[model samples]
Every structure is written in C-alpha cells, then in structure tokens.
Target: MESVVIFDSPGKGRGLKAAKEFWAGDVIFSEASIAAVVFDSLAERICHSCFRRQEKLQRCAQCKFAHYCDRTCQRAAWPEHKVECGAIKAYGKVPNENIRLVARVLWRLDKEGSMVSDMQLTTLDELEDHINDMQEHDLKELKVDVHNFLDYWPRTSKQHLIDDISHIFGVINCNGFSVSDQKGLQAVGVGLFPNLCLVNHDCWPNCTVILNHGNQSAVSTVFHSQQRIELRSLGKIAEGEELTVSYVDYLNLSEERRRLLKTQYYFDCTCEHCKNKTHDDVKMGGKEVDGVKPSDEQVKEATDYCFQMMDKMDKARLNGDYHEVSKICRDCIEKTEPILADTHIYLLRMWSTMSEVKAYLQNFEEAAEYARKMVDGYMKLYHPNNPALGMAAMRAGVTHWQAGLIEIGHGMICKAYAILMVTHGPTHPITKDLEAMRVQTEMELRMFKENEYVYYSMREAALKNKPMTMLHEPRSVEEGIKNLFHRK
Candidate 1:
C-alpha cells in the first residue's frame, strides 16, 4: 500500500499525486534502491558490504577494494562483490561512481528485470533522460564514461551496444538520488529507486526522502538490502496534492535553484518559492518589509562576513578541530546579531554547528542551549514540517538526554519525531533513532514521575492538529511569535 498514484500535469509531464490524505508525520512509502554504489571516497570509511560507518573494517581478502566488518559481511557481499571484484581486478581500480551505478543497473536488469518491483511500478523507458538538454561538455564526458562502463560487461551481457549504455546513462542523469547518511550529512552512495523516481521536483516540496536503516554488516543483509528511499510527508498532504521532493537544497537562492533545476533536471521550477521573489529580492523593489530590520546593504555586509567565517569554521570542523570551529562560530554570531535576520541561513547554520561542536565535546548543557536556539531559528526559517526543523529539535533533545534531563529530552525528541515523520518519514533511520531515544528516555522518566504518559498524550494530540503553513512575512520576532500562537 505504498503511495504511488500517477497523474499528468500541463507542464510537468507524468507526476506523482497522493492517493489518500497523509498526516504531517506519516510515511508515504519506502523502497530499496535498485542500483546502488558506495562512493569511492566512502569505501574505506563505510563498510562495503553493509554501508555502516565504522572504523574497524576488514578488507575483502581477494579484491582488496571491499571492506567488511567480519567474515559474515564478506560472505553476504560475495554474490554482488564477485562481479564488482572481477571488474575492478580487470580494470586495476574501482570504477567511478556513475560507472559503477550504471553497471549495477544493467546487471540487475539482465538478472532481474527491475530491481525493486517486478510488476514495473515504473520503467527506465518512461524516464526523461534530458540527454539533449544536457550541456555539450557534460554529454561528451558522459560518452567517455559510457565507454569505460561498457568494458565491465561480461561477454554475454555485452550484447547491448554502446547506444544501450548511453540510455542507462541518460536514465541516471534523470533520476539518480544521492544516498546520504541518516543525518543527511554526506552522500556516501548513489541509488536508483525506480518507483520513488516518479516524484517530480517542487522548489518548495511537500515531501522529502530519508534513509532508514541500511546494511550494517558485510556478511549478511536482508534480501532487498542496499538502501531504502523512505519518502516522508513534509507537511499535511490532502488527497490529490502533488507529492514532490526537492532535487536540490531548499536554501539555494531562487535564481540558483532555477538554474540547477534547468541544467540538471531539464525543467525550470515555477513553484511558489520560485514564483515570488525572496525578502532580499523584494526589498530591491521598494516594498516595505513587515518587521524592523537592518538596511538591506547592512544586512548583506554582515551576511557576507558570516559566510566567510562559516567557510573557515567548516574546514576546521571537518578536520576535527572543534576549538577553532567554536571560536569562529562565536565571532560569527556576535557580528551577525546586529544586522542579519534571526532566521538568516548563515546565522542558523552557525548556531547549529556550534551546538554540534559542544555536543561532540560532551558539554551537554551548552550543547542543549545552542541546539534550542537552533530549533527557534529553524522554526522561523523553514516550513513548519521541514526535516531541518526536526533535526534541530532532535539535536537539542540529545543534549538534554545526555545532561540527564530525561524529561526535557523525552519531550523534545517526541516533538522532533513528529516533525521528522513529516520530513524524514516514520521509518527513516534518523526518525527511528530519535524515536528509540524517546522511548528509552520515557522509560527512565517513568521510574521517577509515573504519570509522564498523560502529558505526552495531550501534547501529541496538539501536534497532530497543528496546521501546516509557509513561514515568514513578519521580518521581526514579535509578529512571528504572534503569528505562531494564532495558527490553527
């Protein structure tokens, strides 16, 4: 009973629509990737057999390219690994990610017509490759990649010529989804979810994909094991509402978003977000913004400074230097406080990063405070049900949980889960992890309070009935809170 209703649109070609009303925190559907390849950069870091991010990894004895946690993982991966191993041994290096994915697609098609569903919920033939729409340089680069991938085919599988390989390339260009970790931090792999690929892009999308549990072992995994593309309702969806997912980060400026959509997806987004200019852009038109705010030029200068500071903080954070990152972020905050909006992307990001740094260093009280600030910022910046909003709450919940404020952590996590279900789906790994923590925290609280369930039950009812809406018009904090309390 997965969500899979197709409808035609005047401009969007075949599009997915909700078959029934979906509550804000509901899962629309979940499916494993048909073709998946762990990126080379993530190979050593993540278990090749199970995709787990772990340090104690065992390399495949023969190929040396595959790393598993144990013999069990190595054995479970052997079936697929045998072929990939042979290909790598023949080539003397692991193939590029796109090449590997194409190989997986072709191999799966030859062995099993479709990877996820044999009934053909969707088809490669129906996918719009946008090959002609791609830039000339990209096309040429793809052609070379096709040739390289074609060499991996077994003698029997090579029956299809270069043209066939090109079609696979086109399909990938049209529908590939980067498989990121549970946190949506980094894309460690690429996967093709045939049924999920039916989703069309909306600049302000109603749904988002969350990766649920992926394989954790190299030795054994479930039959449909690579990765699951769990589609979650990002907001309350009425029956017949178009089910869409953003192909790019929602924070990208309007112009940048449209450009990426056009170049990559072969369509210009005309969604509401793209249709109306942003506050910054609108200010240029001489309209009065709703709140007391710094002049546009002043805001821009502060934002620019924050961006540069963020870049430095990011590099330091990546290299595991938390001390430097924390200082940079604090300076970033001090400078931005005067001119930038409270919900400025840079400001929110700075707070979120500092919270993470504190959490990493086990400064639970400080982490909780910073994370709570992030939650408020997210509430102002993103949609009511945005995954980022949920993630912010979850971060705060974890810090509270670590600080032994089980009651606070339990409530925050429960709230976070409700929002995450809308954004990451109920089954997403992130959602599941948070939910697990909530349960554990609740159990601990029960040992002390004994009547905690009553409170959460009432809170749950409130969250379920909260109306979904687009954010912002009140550029000031007062109106924002006034609007929130007034929401149905």
Candidate 2:
C-alpha cells in the first residue's frame, strides 16, 4: 500500500493526502529530482556531479566550465553533462541556472518521454504555469529568459516550441524546489521534484521538506549522488489529513506572506493565519516603557525606518560591506529598541543580521549575545519543534561556545539536538554534527565542573604555546562556571 494518495484539494489544484497515520519524524515520502542544475555562481566551486562544495575543484577539460571532485564524479555526471558540455562549448558561455535547468529538463524529456512513476499523480506537462496570472514585469523577465534559452539551446538537441519553453519556465518559477547540499546547510542548486510539488502550502504546515543529498554509506547502495528530497511529518498526522508545506518562510508578517504568495505562486492565501492575522500583533507589536506606551503612529514610523535600513543593510551585505551592514543594523536596533517589542520581526531581523556580521568580524562575545536574543525571539515566534528554530539555536550555541561560555553553549546545543531529532531526525548530516557538538560540549562542561583550575591551566598553556590574539574578550564568565573555583 502507498503511504500517500493524491486527491483534488479544495481550492488547491492537487494535494497529497496521507494514506496512513504518521507520527512526528516519520518519512512520508522520498523522491529524486527529475531534472536539476547547479547555480551559476557556484558552478565552479561546487562539484557539478555530486554538488559538493570545496575550495578547489577540477574543471572539466572539455567545456572548461563544468567542475568535479575527481574522475569518479566526472564519469557519474557525464550522462547529463555530455549534452550540457557540448552546449556550453558551442554557446561560448554558461547560462543562468533557470535557463540551464529548462535545457536539462527538455533533454531528459526528449530521452525518457516523461513517464509517470507508480506514485506520481501529476506530470511535468500538467503542472500549473499561471502565465496569465503573472505580472507584466514577471512576464517580461520570462520573455528575456525564453530568448536566451533559444540562443543557448543546441541545434542537435531535441527542439522545443517557444510556447513549451515559456510554459516550462512558468512551471519552474512556481514549483521548483531549492536543492540543498549534503549537510543541508545551503542551497547549492535548484531541482524539479514532481510529487513533492503536489504538496500544498499552509501557514503552519504539518510537514517539512528535507533535501537529502545522500551520504557516503547510503550513496553506495540505497541512495545515489543524485538530488533527492524527503517529506517528513512534523507532528502526528491522521490517515486522511492533507499533507502541506509552507511555500514561504512562516516567520513573515501575514501581509508580507500573502504578497509573496500572490506574486510568486499567483495565489492569494486565505490560510487561517492570513485570514485571522494570527501573531501579527505580536510580531509587529510596540512596547511601553516608564509607564508610557508607544502610539500607533510612532510604531508605524519606527517600523518604516527599520524596513528602509534593512533594505540598505541587505544591499551592503551583498556587496560584502560588512562594516556598513553592521553600522546599519546597530543604528536600526538602537532606534527601534524602545518602540518595538523584543519579539518584533523588525528587531529580530536586525539581531539576526548583526549576529552574522559580528561573527564574521570575529566579535564572538557580541555575536553570541545577538544570537541568543535571535534564538529567544524565534522560540516565541516559531513552533516549538520547528527546524528553523533548531538551526538558529544551533548557530547561537556555536557562537556561545566560541566565546567560551560553555554552560550556556552546552545547553543551547542540547536544545538544538532535541528539536532537530524531531524535525530533521538523527541521521541527517546537520543533526549528526549537532549531536557531536552536544557530546563534546557535555564533556567539556564536565571537565570544567570537575576542576576549573586544571581546565583553565590546560587552555592557557595551549593558548600560550600558540600565542594567538584574542578578538573578543568575555566581559565576565557566567556565575555557574565562575564560582566553581572561586568559592573558597
């Protein structure tokens, strides 16, 4: 019996419904991408075949563009790359990920004739493109892509009509999934997963998608280097419950989420969260200080300023101007702290950016503070077991650990591991890394508690031998660890 069945969802075109009861952490379905491509920016740094990130990669001698880890990966990718390589050489340059992806899809379809799997209820042709619903700007961009695609398309490959190419681009814009690397830390590419696309969207989804890149042990037998995705149940789902996943980050304001859905997916969300403006007040709420609360007008003004600053900060970050980004975040945070509540999304954004930039600048102590605040805000905004919250906690734990706050760092790592166990499961690379961190932290904490003098002595001796400069000096060690040896 199948684990999931397809049915026409009300309002939604088609939806996947669970055929049997599934508890949290259960794998509902696993699928491989029918077509995929590495991002153009990472084309050289990441393995074109295995999608691994490395400082140095071996470039394909033929195309002089496609890269690989070694001969094994090059051979594995040859079936697809054989055609792509010829096109890149013929065209004289590589196209964007979207165009390249469309080309790969066309090549695959021409070869296999788009056969449906036993469990697949929909085909690539049937997927909605919403071409008519697209805005003029979006359509214009699509037109540009279609033109470029035609130029880059090989004359020898199977020819596709202009309408077919346009429709394929439309489908991808709405349905394509971000393919993460093996550790699931960052998206290295984009892929088309047919059945996974059938899962509808929800503000608070009961299922989360995991892009399984396959590990060394599994790669040899069950899983391959191909891009595969898994749908995991986030909580106990009934047999007949319709499986859903969030199309956008659920942390956004209701209005923002609705705008994104309408613009990108061509659908106006009427999800309960959107309809009821759930958590909107808290996410944008203003706080009172000294018995004086901020007025609605003041709150709006402050939020507007924060939004403008965040826009600039994002651009600065993209430009690699960390100092400018840090300054903008600091200014926005200071200006809005009094008016906005601690959990306000705007403040959280600043904290998140500040944490990242500070960490990059090696201000570990300050970065850890901002990361802790970010995690605290996330804890309130996200579901108790949300994977995002777990990732944030994991990052905060690492920051704290880097700053030598072992007690708190150990606790945060344990918290992340517990949440990831449910969201990502134990076998995921990220979860495995967190588990190792948890163990190592626990051991260090035990050692420090056993004898802080000896622990500090060993650390000092190691540091003295290396003679490194400290970028961040902790203001004070936590009371728990500080008092262990001082109390006499």
Best by lDDT: 2
Model 1: CA > 4 A from native: 1-3, 114-116, 181-186, 214-227, 278-292, 318-320, 403-408, 423-429, 439-488
TM-score for every candidate vs. truth? 0.80, 0.90
Tens-digit per-residue lDDT, 385-470, candidate 1: 76656666776787777665667878888988887666665545666677788888788678548665774564447546972221
* TM-score, prediction 2: 0.90
State residue 42's C-alpha deviation in candidate 2, in Å: 1.5
lDDT of each residue in 157-233, candidate 2, tens digit only: 87889999999898888888876666766667788888887888888889888776665333332345445677889
Error of 2 at 407 (Å): 1.4
C-alpha RMSD of each candidate structure in angstroms: 9.2, 7.8
